[model samples]
Target: MADVQTGTRRAAGPRDTVWREPAGIGQTRRARPEVVRVASKAIRKSAAIVLLLALWEVLPRLEVFDPVFVPPLSENLAAWYDLLLSGQLLEHFQASLTRSLAGFGLAIVLAIPLGLLIGWYTPVADLLMPLLELFRNTSAVALLPVFILVLGLGETSKITFVLYACSWPILLNTVSGVKTVEPLLIKSARSMGLGPIRLFQKVILPAAVPTIFTGVRLAGAYSILVLLFAEMVGAKAGLGYLIQDSQSSFRITDMYAGIITISVLGLLFNLLLLTVERRFSTWRT
Candidate 1:
């Protein structure tokens, strides 16, 4: 009777607890909230963009500004389509891209090595700092006439102008990056018998790359600005030339189209640099 009672008690206790969940089930539930939080943050950032686009589409219809001066987004889009169809946009885009890339490329090639040297050697830094200050303080616009006179109103002049404008920030940032590398890292590498070249290649370069990229991004922006200015000053075929011509002819729609194109190009350039930076600097992230 007692055995029978004990068996009954055991059977009724909890019925095996309905297969209780394994450990960490609560953690899995917690992770879901984290994911939702991240998604919400992304949505919040994008909200402003959506609002701006809506305002862009609605402002002209409300007639807050003259439809002629502030054409509806649809009219601007139509102007873009017309230019695309005529192939004028493509030609000018190619010209502007070529000049910008050439100048920006030259700046990168020249600035980085020179900057590394200046940052690596005290004497080099002392010698170049004064000269760097002198030229960097001078405006690129002020030198436009000099470049035009010396290099002539040609592709070379435009490329040179972009090079001059982009070099300063890139060089300066690279120097700062190199100088700011943690001394501990360098000492550790030296203790491991790493030579100067290997030390720089393995430790200094990697450490400084984030700062260097900051300058590169700045140079990219300067590249576009300088290219547009250079193209406007003298160019038979380019986006700047198209904008100038359209404005002079009172083709406001087409001018806006050109401005939009340049803005889009600048955005793409920055996005490209950002993507590159993220790919190379994953550890920092």
Candidate 2:
């Protein structure tokens, strides 16, 4: 009987001592909260968007506002769809995008380097500060006539206006970012015998990146706003022109469609910048 009992008993093994989870249990434990978090955030954003759309759709129908002024959301959507199908929307969008992007790109290329130079050197900042302050304080729109006159009614004028509008925010933010780097960090880097260029590249630039990004985001928003105004003032094919034309023609729905398109485009541009900023800015995390 003892021999038979001993034979039935299992031998002690590594598997017996080790705690083993079922497949996927660990992953589920780790991923579940993240999934829930993302889903909840998405649900909240979607709910807000849906509620706004519902209000937009219902308000005009209720006759509280003039239907002519605030066309039903559905009508605007239908107009947008029609425009899209006819390719008119695409043409205007492409034209606007080209001009806006061209101006924004030029602004970035010019502003960042000049910002760095001004921020790094006291003499340069002193020399440029008064003129910069004057220009920055002046309204971008106020300079529109000057640009149109100098650059003429060509694409160059429109792009130049956008560049001027975008430059101030980027330049200001970059200077602020560079100036705000911790003095202790600079001292520590100097103590380590890091050269000025090396210290700037390794320590200063990294520290300044977040603030610079803030300026870049501001510039991006400014670029779109200025571009729209420039387009509206004088353009044959752009969303601004579309809106102007529709308004003149009393095509309320078409005008709303243009407005909606620009709103969406602005939102998309901000989202794109945010994504890029987050990708490059892991240090903030």
Candidate 3:
């Protein structure tokens, strides 16, 4: 009878046992699909750029385009590498970056507060709107000569040109952001006994952040574009100067390298702004 009971207990033990996967294994299995999804999305988004680069590489080699005027992408990349090795690339990049950042930063600092003031106060808007409209209608390119004449052909002129170009977008967008805050949000805040300053801090500013960021991104692009033009016209060291100089000297590969560098810089700057925008506006999500 004891042997029979022992045998029965042994048989039941297998059925009573429970099994679980190791925690790491289960987590890895769940994570793989997410990783794959992210990779696939990135690849899809980059497909067009890859196609364009392939065409750039092949077309010149195939003689479809004049190689003298438009060198193969590989040649341009080699030239870029040479420039990097010689430290010329870094020098030019620093010059351009300094001017761009100075102007861009100043514009942001000045425009946002002034924009807030104009947007919030009707009397101020009434006084400034006409002048803003007039200046806003004037092309930055047309005013380039004026800046050069007044500010002179130094760093001041270049940076001021960038500032002038970048400020309009940010200022306009800020004003619009503030004015377009939903009336319902304001009323809700008021009902909660929130004062004007608290209302602005808690409700208005948060609501306006998306619009404000849109302006900031636009200003960022303008900073690069306007600074490039300024550098091309007057600066001794910058990507624009490199491109202009290379083109004049018939160094097609170097010109293309400079052009590519500018494009990459613009892309990277925009990406940075986007990251910041996302951080600030996560409340929307």
Q: Against the unseen true structure, what C-alpha lDDT does each candidate score?
A: 0.88, 0.88, 0.89
In model 2, where do residues sit more than 4 Å from their true spots? 1-38
Checking candidate 3 for backbone clashes, the offending pairs are none
TM-score of 3: 0.86
lDDT of 3 by residue, 126-193 (tens): 99999999999999999999999998999999999999999999999999999999999999999999
Candidate 2: residue 2 lDDT (0-100): 20
- Which ranking of candidates, highest lDDT first? 3, 1, 2
In terms of lDDT, model 3 sits at: 0.89
Model 2 clash pairs? Answer: none
The C-alpha local distance difference test score for the whole of candidate 2 amounts to 0.88
Error of 1 at 144 (Å): 1.4
Question: How well does candidate 3 match the true structure, expressed as C-alpha RMSD?
Answer: 12.6
Clashing pairs in model 1, backbone N/Cα/C closer than 3 A: none
Which regions of candidate 3 fall more than 4 Å away from where they truly are?
A: 1-32
TM-score result, candidate 2: 0.86
Per-residue alpha-carbon lDDT of model 1 for 1-285, expressed as tens digits? 123222223232555533324436644655566677668877897999888767777988899878888888888889999999999999999999999999999999999999999999999999989998999999999999999999999999999999999998899999999999999999999999999999999999999999998899999999998889888888898899989888889999899999999999999999999888777776663
Q: Of models 2 and 3, which has the larger lDDT?
A: 3
List the candidates' TM-scores in order: 0.84, 0.86, 0.86
